[model samples]
Target: MKDFSAEITYKTSRSSGAGGQNVNKVETAVTAIWNVMESAVFRFDEKLRISEKLKNRINSEGLLQMTASESRTQVQNKKIVTEKMLDLVEKALFVPKKRLATKPSKGQIQKRIDNKKKLSEKKENRKFRF
Candidate 1:
């Protein structure tokens, strides 16, 4: 149920890509805006998390802007913007798996103690014969 067309607003700017005269003349770079409150792309909790996580990226109006000027063509810029938006959305959705608490095994503890005893023995042997 991801309707990116309605969710995003695009604005084009002059591109610096390798298009010779076309790059300087045509405004092909794409800048897209996603309205967090209005979009159907993210749920309530997801939007909240995204807002919190990307607080610096969001403007005072709570809009997320992504600019793509890497390519000369408008189509390519549009595609890049879409891909970047998707990546941001996916990153917001991800929850890191928690690590379980674990105690060292008896064998591991025994080996560590054994190693310490060996080290102590070696140091003791190096002491002056007084």
Candidate 2:
């Protein structure tokens, strides 16, 4: 929505990767947490939709959490997690168009029957009658 950054809080930890000494010395991994139940960026209905759709990512306390550790810097990882959370929230709020059920045309049904009869008659003619 319109910048939910204000509602997001971050936690950082040491990242595990091939960063050598840097990985051991610095806390590069970042986790972005947002309280879906207490968010002011989204309306009540939108918040409910986000909670329902992102239930897997949300904790029992109704907080949505995302972690990013791909990069070797805290700033990059923080940005990554924030972007991820925003993208997820946006996806959860999306409503797909309803699908309508339809049946095949009469012409299509006729074609299937015609093909079946043609094969049956061809096999019948192959019989040996003396």
Best by the lDDT measure:
2
Q: Which consecutive 10 residues in model 2 have the weakest lDDT in total? A: 1-10
Candidate 2, 35-108: lDDT as tens digits: 99898788899888888999888999998888999998899899889888888888889999999999999999
Candidate 1 clashing pairs, residues 3+ apart or interchain: none
What stretches of model 1 exceed 4 Å from their correct place?
1-5
**Model 1 clash tally?**
0
lDDT (Cα, 0-100) at 39 in candidate 1: 67
* Candidate 1 lDDT over residue span 91-121, tens digit each: 8767899999999999999999999999999
What is the model-wide C-alpha lDDT for candidate 2? 0.90
Each model's lDDT comes to: 0.84, 0.90
Give me the overall lDDT of model 1: 0.84
